[model samples]
Target: MKIIAISNQKGGVAKTTTCLNLAAYISKKKKVLLIDCDKQANLTKNLGMEGAKTSINDLFLKRKFDVVNVRKNLDLIPSSVDFVGIDLLIQGELARESILKKALDRLESNYDFVFIDCPPDMNLVTVNALTASNYVIIPVQATQFSMDGVNIMIDFIGGIRESINPKLNLLGILVTHFDKRLKISKSIEQDFKDNNWEMALFKTRIRRNTAIENSQHKDYRMTIFEYDNQSKGALDYSNLAKEILKLIKNLN
Candidate 1:
């Protein structure tokens, strides 16, 4: 099984969007687990479940009661606002630093892909997510700070590879909330290319679509085929998924 962390230190970059739809699309054809490592519970809500205080925290801490099951190949470990406590927990208990990796170990054989939606922070929680991840999907908002808060992230990934997960590597960096007409977006996109990080840039950039934002407000994540199914958003993510699967298949 391949475990990927959908993360970035930047918020509002559609990190949640990428995680939700990617999980949904993959589940359409295979067994998938969408882990809500974020405290916001957005991923859990999209799955039509509410946050359970004892949910992800329970699994991360290795509670005996934590168990995973599936309905039609999509299983999720819910998270709630209470998960903010998990950050402190992970820091205080060095023994639990690798808790997420251990929890995933128990469920690996049953899943084809395990997607973790990480909070937009570089803390103990992110450390656990990164350490457990086989791949990292960095979502960048195509606006001004598109590349602003990336250095710390790069440094953290480097440190993790050196000390924790040497096999972990970047899956891609997708540009989100893009407005092609904007000079700012265009400039940053160029900046990204100049830095030689385009290897993961998808040809189908997710443009700023009202439909995509609307789906989030309505608390749903439509597959690229579902979100304006014929719109660029759907098509782009579908193409992105194809690119992702090519790499995932290579792993097996």
Candidate 2:
């Protein structure tokens, strides 16, 4: 299985959104599993699985994960708020950074792809995600602060590669919340063009759409495709999934 971590050390950069949509789109043809490693449990709640009895926290604290299939071809290791204090427990533990990696090793062969939604920080939680991931997809928003976060994330990933997972590869940089009409968004795109991206900078930019946020505010948190397949948000994400699949094939 190809384990991919969708991470960005900045909140509201479409990290969870990208993770959910990509997994949902891919699950149509491939067995996919999503690990919500963020303590906030945004992905879990968004999928309407708010009260998960067993989460990634249990996997960390007990070394056991009870997988839940929210839909066909898609399984999830949900997250809980209890995970917020896990760093305290992880400290002083042997191979603390590899805990998630070890746990995931048990289930890797069951799915064609595994997507990890990491927390918006460079903490032990994210460390575990990176350690378990074979590839990473960074979601960069079209904002100045988001661009700065991208630079910080690069250095942080470099440190992880040197000390932990040397085989971890940066799959690509995905621009999210992009608005062609916005001058700032255009500038950010130009900045990425000028910057020396060591990895692929994806051409499928997720355009800013109200439907994306509306997915969460509904009765049951739904994905863009479920909310409105014809919407720009759904179309962009579908295209993104196709592009990612093509890229993966080429890389292999």
Candidate 3:
């Protein structure tokens, strides 16, 4: 199984959205598992699993945790608000960074892909995610601030690769919340090109769409594909899943 961490130290970059929709799209033909590592538990709440009895917190605490089957081929290990203090709890433990890697070693073999929805910070939890992942996907907005976050994540990943997971690789940088109608969007796209980031950028840009946001509303809580297959958000995620599959195939 290939483990991928959808991470960015910056918030409001659609990291949870990408993890949710991408896993939903790929689970159509492949076994997928999602690990909600964010303390906010947005991914868990969006999936309507907030009341889950067992969560990723249990896994980290070395207590019994359940793998919830949220969709046909998509399962999830939900997050807990308690996870906010997990870093402090695990800090004194031996080999603290490898805790997640060891836990995932037992759970990942059954799935084709495992996507981790990481928190919006470079902390112990994010480090654990990176250490356990085979690849990482950084999702960012077209704003300069988002680009700054991407640069920070790149440097952070370099440290992780050098000292922790030597096999870890960056899959690509995904542009999320993109809108061609905005001049700022065009400018950022140009900036990316000017920086010679074409090789590291994904061709699929997730457009800003209401359907995407509406799908995650409390009243609906549906995947983009399930909420509106014809929407641009669905199409983008579908294309992303295909691109990721092809990329992983070539990498392997």
- Per-residue lDDT of 75 in model 1: 80
Question: What C-alpha lDDT values do all the predictions have?
Answer: 0.76, 0.88, 0.90
Q: Rank the candidates by TM-score, best first.
A: 3, 2, 1
lDDT of 3 by residue, 1-252 (tens): 899999998899999999999999999999999999999999999999997988989888884678999999999999988888898898898988988889878875699999999999888999999999999999988643345666788899999999999999999999888888877877776666776766888989889999999999999999999999999999999999999999999998
Which 10-residue window of candidate 2 scores lowest in summed lDDT?
Answer: 191-200
* CA shift of 236, model 1, Å: 1.6
Give a tens-digit lDDT track for model 1, residues 1-252: 999998898778888888877777778898888888888888777655674445887766655335344346888788877788677766767555578887787776888988889987887888888889999988888875545576567777889999988989887777788898988878876777787866667665777877766666655544455556777677667777887998777866
Model 1 TM-score (2 dp): 0.90
Q: For this target, which candidate reaches the highest lDDT against the unseen true structure?
A: 3
Per-residue lDDT tens digits for candidate 2, residues 154-207, read 888889999999989888899888887888887875666677663468888899
RMSD of each: 2.3, 1.3, 1.2
Give the higher-lDDT candidate: 1 or 3. Answer: 3
TM-score: which candidate is best?
Answer: 3
Candidate 1 overall Cα lDDT vs. reference?
0.76
Clashing pairs in 1: 224-234
Please give the TM-score that candidate 2 achieves against the real structure. Answer: 0.96
